[model samples]
Target: MLLPARTLRFCVATAAAAIAVTVGLTGCGSDDDSGSATGTTATASTTTAASATTGSGQAAGATPSVEELQTTLAILSDPAKTTQDKVAIVVDGEKRATNIESMTKALAGYGTLKFVVSDVKVTGDTATAQVVISSPNGDAPPMPLTWQQVGGKWKLSDASTCVLLGFAQAPCTP
Candidate 1:
């Protein structure tokens, strides 16, 4: 039996959204050699400071408004925006490497993904947001994310337990 077009679209959108969340949470690694290079402490410190300051600056530039972040989340959550043509810019501009592949897999019936933002904290131009994501069968634990404001916009910066889950090996940088 053929499902309604709307139903098919809903399934696709839900799958895509799930992939975006998973990839956004666990992708990318900084190329800095601080951990391996001896006597690179100074460089590591500088890098950390720079990243922190950039986040702070971005959070500060928005007139203390959560509107931008909220709007971004809303747009991303929309099913209609799941198309590659529509989401390519967001994925590429944000440097979300894992999202595309994960999204494709999710669309192919891997599972469902859903999320909700519970809180947000902004200091200067940097902000941290807390979000919880759930899986399709409702068997997996909810993934918690710590999002950071960068370049005047919020992006997923860290996941508390992604490595443990084996979804990704590296943490997001920037």
Candidate 2:
């Protein structure tokens, strides 16, 4: 079946929101590679900071919880949120503004679709989240989503959006 823009955007938005949660949970710093004993202390502080943000027992730099991710998706899907708000969660916000209306309309058709996070792998400022989408037709195979941490928020990478929109892997501006 053809993937409608709204449906694809829903997946992308969900993944992006989840990644953003990861950023908030993990903080904007990477683990120190120093073997010095003092570095261990620093690690503890990082973990404490992460725990404060997530309120879970998650260690510093750990992935976000599945529930947090799902919550983000739910918020984004709310019709009460403005188009500007929804677009802000997208990878290329300004570029996507023009198409938000059409995409929102398309979203109305696929109410049965569900997104399940399979795994999330983070490396530096980039992350790959695997998601399984299920609908009336059946469960779609797992799809790996690419996300980038930008200005302390997680957003979809241009490449991921391009692929989701059925474009070739080229240098996409949006």
Q: What ranges in model 2 sit over 4 Å off?
A: 1-62, 67-81, 165-174
Measured against the true structure, the TM-scores of the candidates, in listed sequence, are: 0.38, 0.51
The candidate that achieves the highest TM-score relative to the unseen native structure: 2
Query: How much does candidate 2 score in TM-score?
Result: 0.51
Backbone clash count for every predicted candidate, in the order shown:
10, 0
Q: How good is model 1 by TM-score?
A: 0.38
lDDT of 1 by residue, 1-174 (tens): 233778745644454455456555432434443442111000000011222334444423333234444344434333334444323324233344354334333333222334444445444544444344443333223233333444455543433222212342233344
Candidate 1: minimum summed lDDT over ten consecutive residues — where? Answer: 38-47
Residue 99 in model 2: lDDT? 53
Cα deviation of 7, candidate 2, in Å: 23
Instruction: Write out the backbone clash pairs for model 1.
Output: 55-126, 56-125, 56-126, 57-125, 58-125, 59-124, 59-125, 59-126, 60-124, 60-125
The best candidate in terms of lDDT: 2
Listed per candidate, the RMSD to the true structure in angstroms reads 18.5, 18.0
